[model samples]
Target: MTLSPDEIITVTLWGVPINATLLFTWIVMAVLTGASMLITRNLRPDVPPNRWRTALEVVVQGIQNQIAEIAQGPSRHLLSFVGTLFLFVAGSNLLLVIPGFRPPTSSLSTTTALALSVLVAVPLFGISRRGVGGYLQSYLRPSPVMLPFNIIAEASRGISLAIRLYGNIMSGAVIAAILLSVAPFFFPVVMDLLGLLTGMIQAYIFAILATVYISSATAPQTLSSPQKDAQ
Candidate 1:
């Protein structure tokens, strides 16, 4: 059985091979973009909201609320970034039910890319909220000696995020494949339903972890009890 989508070459453009990972990633993005455009094409306050619009709003609002709760602050600034991450991951996994479809998340390259995006976004959001100097200074909190450790921690976050997501999704795919081959036919169908649920859970987890990392960077640091007592 095929393990990673990277092994499957779907097309070649200008001598560069495009793997199933890129193919399905593009398909997911295109589908999301087209659906968004179609749903919002006639958006206007004067007109009554259609079912599609209502569903879209509910999803957006749900994400915003989750962000607000996690960050313990306003969520408007995070809606787009967090929402996109959740939707993309969730959408990719949910599509696994389709015959011959491979989830991009099952590939380490794709998960690494997503994790790296979160890595980059954390600092961008941090620097935007706190000046570059302030964000940099966060690494030296409590003592300058901790700077290297803090830097290491920051770097490790991306690696951990990538491995965690890739391992979970890839393992799921592998298990399902094994079960399909050896187990009863109906058993695989049950596993597919469970896989869908697992996919949604993983997407939620990835997004929440991203939000937590970003929120730690962007949220204002408060004075410690000792510092407060000194004042």
Candidate 2:
């Protein structure tokens, strides 16, 4: 049985039920990363690339530009993570279009895991760039009194990010499934096109919001004013 994002498929191995969506997600991410690395390894800086290589390069460069423009300065170091995440999320979401293949991103478990990672990484990256003290100080924006609200808002964002993507994708898939089940022959094509578009936009949103969150968390609150400079 294939795992899809909306449903969690479990496999029994040695009487232990392992989550198939999680396993598939890990595999998809590993494959994407490995393929990118292999492409880099066999690259020739002076030679022309094939269409596949060119396309991959274009995607990578576009993601790099997004990261650079948002994060700015030395913060562009986050390009790799953003690029990898975008690829992983987009690739996983494509499983819906594949015949008999279920998307890993359709499941709440998978999306929530990814969202948690982004939330966790934000603080870690912030602390790494600005000392722990500076990172903490950034949250005390406007005034120290606002710190608790800021922290709560940050926590809610992670939940909202995960639930928003998961809900939309899952609901879309459900609608598509119902339509196909009722009219198997003529319905899926339109749904598939819509799914593709939605999938792409969702991936872009996830990555962009991630960049924005990272920028906000690591922003420096200067001594001159209450204005905090977000990444």
Which candidate should be chosen as best, given TM-score against the real structure? Answer: 1
Q: Which candidate is the best by lDDT?
A: 1
Clashing pairs in 1: none
| lDDT string, candidate 1, 110-178, tens digits | 999999999999999999998898899999998999999999999999999999999999889878878
Model 1 clash tally, residue pairs: 0
What TM-score goes with each of the models? 0.95, 0.87
Query: What C-alpha lDDT, on a 0 to 100 scale, does residue 168 get in candidate 2?
Result: 80
Estimate the lDDT of model 2: 0.79
lDDT of each: 0.92, 0.79
Looking at candidate 2, the ten consecutive residues that score lowest on lDDT are: 1-10
TM-score between model 2 and native:
0.87
lDDT of 2 at 223: 76
> Which consecutive 10 residues in model 1 have the weakest lDDT in total?
183-192
Q: What is the lDDT of residue 181 in candidate 2?
A: 80
